[model samples]
Target chain A: MNENRNNLKLGIFITLGTICFVAALYLLGAKQNLFGGTFEIKAIFNNVNGLQKGNNVRYSGINVGTVKEIVILNDTAIEVNMMVQIDVHEFIKVDAIASLGNDGLMGNKLVNISPGGSRSRTIEVGETLLSINELDADEMLRRLEETNKNISLITSSLVGIVDKIDKGEGPIGTLLNDNNMALDLAKTMTNIRELSFQTASLSQNLSKSFNNFQSSENTIGMLMNDTVLAAEIRTVVDELKNFGTNSEKISSDLNTIVSGIKKGEGTVGTLLSDSIANDDIIKSIDNLQKGSEAFNENMQALKQNFLFRRYFKKLEKKK
Target chain B: MIQTKGQFQSAKRFLFLVGDIGQFTLRFFREGFHKPFEWKEILKQCGEVGYRSLSLVGVTAFIMGLVLTIQSRPTLVEFGAESWLPAMVSVSLIREIGPVITALICAGKIGSRIGAELGSMRVTEQIDAMEVSGTNPFKYLVTTRVLATSLMLPLLVIFADTIALYGSFLAVNIKGAVSFQLFFNQVFETLEFSDLIPSILKSFFFGFIIGIIGCYMGYNSKKGTEGVGKSANSAVVVASLMVFILDLIAVQITDLFYEL
Candidate 1:
């Protein structure tokens, strides 16, 4: 009787434990599409990489099934078969795209399916899912390498430009480097300012001179009241003219005498016709040429000398 | 002379320990497969280890789930992901907490009991008497006990996980409300075969270690009554240690395969 009671208690415990186990199994298995109506779909890939069977299959981010098997078709291609729940099969279409992706930032591989074209027909059972290869890490690294090369080239060009700018190698460089250009600019500005001031003063002086010219209290104005003096001046002018004609006749006689002297007609003429006179004239002309050459040499010497330069500067200041 | 005798005795004891445990494990495997199976005894053991441990496991699981939910609430709120609580709790419980809690309870309850009972039997020579009789003591004792623990613990874990999720649902309702249907849907929705299988499988390993360690220590006990106490104590300690070790190994394997 005691054994029977113990057995019964044990039976109760066992039954309860079994029930719990079964319940848990049902819940967990149900979630895995084990107890549900599901359809299978196959997909072919160039490379499955780390993907495995029992990985999730999702459509538009919602998990619909699990990978059932993975097979190698050739050296390059892999085939993945998935079991999707029947209820979600309608979402699969004739042109649905299947690709490998990770679950989260840190998660296992999953098969993600993109929705097919709206105009396309729904997918039938036993039909293959179109496979897409994502931009994997290696491809991303290759792009990064290209980008880095471009960046380096750009940076080197920028450095070269900066070096040229620093060394002042172009027109802008001359503008920056030349001290004479700056001095010339300053001198031109100063001269323009002084010229403007002088022009203003000259305009004022000219206006005053014109006003003085128009005034009646001048010597030119007294000449208008002296008509009788003007008539007496005319009589004196006629007498002077007769005397001027007599002087002209005597001058002409002198000119004839000079010509006879040149011919050696008289005692004075001999002296004028001598070779010593011609020699004396030539000597004077040579002296004049030598003096001019000496002047030119002196001027050249003066231009070369610092003292002469100072004297020229003083002359400029006086001007 | 005394030292030499003592050394020889210690060496003998060590040999006996090895021999006894080896024979016990071998007999357990053999009897596990043997015909005219002791289903009654096995069921009884399942009751003691599985059903009886449920209340304690359920309470602990509930509290664990409640605390995990409440603690995770603030962080989830910060992320504006309070909706993820049900799924998160379910995954955590299924993957780790459920198996560990169930195994721990079995270790404390079933492990100590097996050790103490078998230890007492050893000290009293009752086991020897059974062996001397026409009955096979190993089949009657070790196999049934080991089978009971191995089968019961996984079942217990499943129950514990279910109750814990219920507790988490209540916890979620403390500051907010999620419909029971929605919560359960979310819980099952986020879970996959990967999460379910690995956790369930690890519990069997936990059960095996708990059973074998308890039986080993108790079966090879010495010093009569004092040995019985020591056996019970050591069984709990060693079983708990082995549980942690097995859990570590299971986690590594699960990570290698599931990668989740």
Candidate 2:
């Protein structure tokens, strides 16, 4: 009976111990993705940032796998093999990106697998995923140093500009500081206002003259506005135009006649242009003069007789 | 001159003790596998060593875990890492505190018990009677107790670790809120096979050391009640000291492998 009790106690103790151990192993193995249907995929990176085997592989922030192994391919590339649960296979595609990240502020390194575009196929077993190198501490520090230098330059420039402005050295500073310039600018503005007032008055006067020209009572306005006078004037102008037309016709006929004479084509033209006829005319006049002279002699002889002398005396008394 | 002579005598005695232990270890290996196995006695001793020590180890482990959590809370809270309570406590218990403390406790309880029992047996000539009767006293007493301790200490450590983690979960709830499932998940999340298996392997060595030292002291005890008391006391002291030394060696070895 004692042996039986001893056996029972030992059995229970050993059983409990075994249960504890198995439970621990199950939990730990589950965490490590040890007891699951898993698939392997590769990621090649320029730098892993201290990532090691057994580190977690997360899919869009969910822990789905562990880093199975790491191989240094060359100086600049490293190959990391990861074992992920088969369940998340569809969520990870062929074009998925893998990058290194920390678990927390100061935690272990892990591989982050981000999903790709929906059009891409799911990643195949043992396929290598694309890697994007993260901004590591060194790179961040370098960029920060550059930014600091730029900020320093900008601040220096700002200080120079501010100093110049404080010293009243530039145009803006002079505008702010010079009271005499301000007074001149104010006077210029006032003069411009006075000139605009005078221009407005001149415009008003011109407008009044235009109104007077538009009135129907004045002669100039009547010329512009009286319809009856305008029509009469138009009739007179029409008659003058007709007269001018008639004069033009008469002058045209005269021009034709003159041109006919100048061309020596008619009797008057022959009389004017014939040099032989002119000589004959001159000879006839000479003959006539001679006959008149002879007749005058005969008359003188009759006057010497009594009857012709009495008739000549009576014609002179009548004159 | 007398002082020099005394120091030299002490050195000689220490060397002699080391030689005796070495011889004793060799003799155990040689005679241990001989026929007439002590299976029934080993089972009985397993009950006495493992099952009987479970309650005490469990209670000690619980207090240890609770105290550790409470003490570590302020520092972790200062860093805003209060969420790491479970993982931190679990790793601490399983890695170093759980196995080593369990070994020390066993060295105190089981080691002294084995030493006193065997010492009394030797003092009363019970072992001699067994030898006269052609029953091997070393095989029956020393081998069975050693075997039982070696087998039981690891089981005890596993129990202690589990109970301690439970205690830590309770303590975590004292000042904060954490579900049992979440706390245990956090604990197991940080615990890997590497953290677990090496510690467990070291506990086996711890057990072996405890068993061997106790048995050595007790089996070779001088003939008297005083000698029996001395054997029990020396067993506890030597076992405890050996536990710490073994733990140091275990940590170094674990570190070396972890480096790789």
Candidate 3:
């Protein structure tokens, strides 16, 4: 009885221990996808950043698979084979990007399978995924050092530019530094101000003159505004134009007469042009004068005769 | 000259003691596995070794886990890695602390008890009487005890590891909040077969050392009450030392196998 009880206790102890061990083992194995339906996929990388077999393969930040194998293909290529759970396998398309990343800061390295573009086809078994190699720590630190050097160079150049500006060494510098130029500028500004004042007063006086000249009392104003006088003056000017035309015609006729006389074309032209005719005209004029004097003497003799004396006395008394 | 001679005699005796233990171990393998196997006594020893030690181991494991968590929390909090507390503590306990602590406790409690019991029996001529009666005392006592420890210690370590993690969960909730499911999930997430298998495997060696050292010290004890006391004292000390040495070796082998 005692032995049986001891054996029973021992059995219970062993059974409980086995239960714990098996439960823990099952959980860990399940995490590794030991019992799950899974498919394999491949990726080639230049570097894996120390990712190893059994590292998690996460899809879009969720762990969907685990790395099954890591093989060094050549000097530059590493082939990573992953066994992903079947349920999530559909989400990983042919163009999925496989890269390496960390679980947390200072955590284990893992394979990150980011989903591909929207239109990519479903992934096939054992198909190689496109990969972007993670920048290792040494490379990142090297780039940071280069950037620091460049920043120092940029800062030094900026300091030089600032110093040059402080010393007034360029076009803006000259404008700042030359005292005589400032004085000339001030004088020019003063002259412009005085000229503007004078211009304003001159414009005012010109406007006043224009106003005065616009009234009809002024001659220029009458010439501008008297419509009737202007029309009369226009008529006189027209008559004067006619007189000029008539004088031109008369002068033409006189010119013709003078030319005819010079040519000795008529009797008056012959009397003027022929010297013998002119002398005969002078002799006839002298005989006609002598006859007129004899007539007058005869008439006086008849009035003194007695036969007509009474008739002459009666005509004189009637007068 | 006299002191040198005495020092040389002591060294020679120590060498002879080692030789005796080795010879004894050889004899145990040769004689212990043959017919008339003491399965009943082995089962009894397993009860004594496994069930009797369970509470002590469980309580010690709990305190160790709780204390470790509380101590580690401030440092992890400094790094803002308090979320890593479960993984970090579980790995520490499983990989190093659980096996070593449980073995040490057993070495003190079980190793000394076996040593003193066997030593008193040997000193009182009980072992000699068993031999006269045609019973193999070494097989009946030493082999069964050793086998019991070898088998039971791994189970004890498994129990201790589970209890320790429970204690750590409670400790984590002392100042902060974490669900039991989440705590366990985190614990199991970082634990791999590599971490789990080697720890439990090393525990078998720890059990073997505790059993054999205690049995060896007691079986070869000098006569009298003083000898019994000496054997018991040396068993605990030597078993504890061997447990540490074995732990060091286990860690080195694990590292090599895992390529850590």
Return the candidate ranking by DockQ, descending. 2, 3, 1
Best-fitting candidate, scored by DockQ: 2
Expressed as tens digits, the lDDT of each residue in A3-57 for candidate 1 is 6877777667667767866766687687667998999888999877688777889
Global Cα RMSD, each model? 25.2, 14.4, 18.7
Q: Candidate 3, which segments miss by more than 4 Å at Cα?
A: A117-119, A153-319, B1-11
Q: Which stretches of candidate 2 lie over 4 Å from their true place?
A: A138-319
lDDT of 2 by residue, B1-260 (tens): 99999999999998998899888778778777887888999999999999999999999999999999999999999999999889889989999999999999999998999999888889999999999999888889888888889899999999999989989989999999999989987887778888998889999989888888999998889959999999999999999999999999988998888752
lDDT of 1 by residue, B1-260 (tens): 99999999999987986677677678788677978687777777776777677789889989988999999999989978888899889999989988997898789888999999889988998889999996676677777788888887887787788789999999999999889999998887778767878987999989988998888788877898999999999889878988999999999999998777
List clashing residue pairs in candidate 1. none
The stretch of ten residues in a row with the least summed lDDT in candidate 3 chain A is: A169-178
Best TM-score among the predictions, by candidate number: 3
i-RMSD per candidate, Å:
2.7, 0.6, 0.8
| Clashes within 3 Å, all models in order | 0, 0, 0
> Candidate 3 residues B18-132, lDDT tens each?
8888888798789778978998888889999999999999999999999999999999999999999999999999999999999999999999999999999999999999999
How much of the true A–B contact set does each candidate keep? 0.71, 1.00, 0.94
User: Docking category for candidate 3?
Assistant: medium
Across A67-163, the per-residue lDDT of candidate 2 in tens digits comes to: 9999999999999999999999998999999999998887789999999999999999999999998889888999999999999999999999888
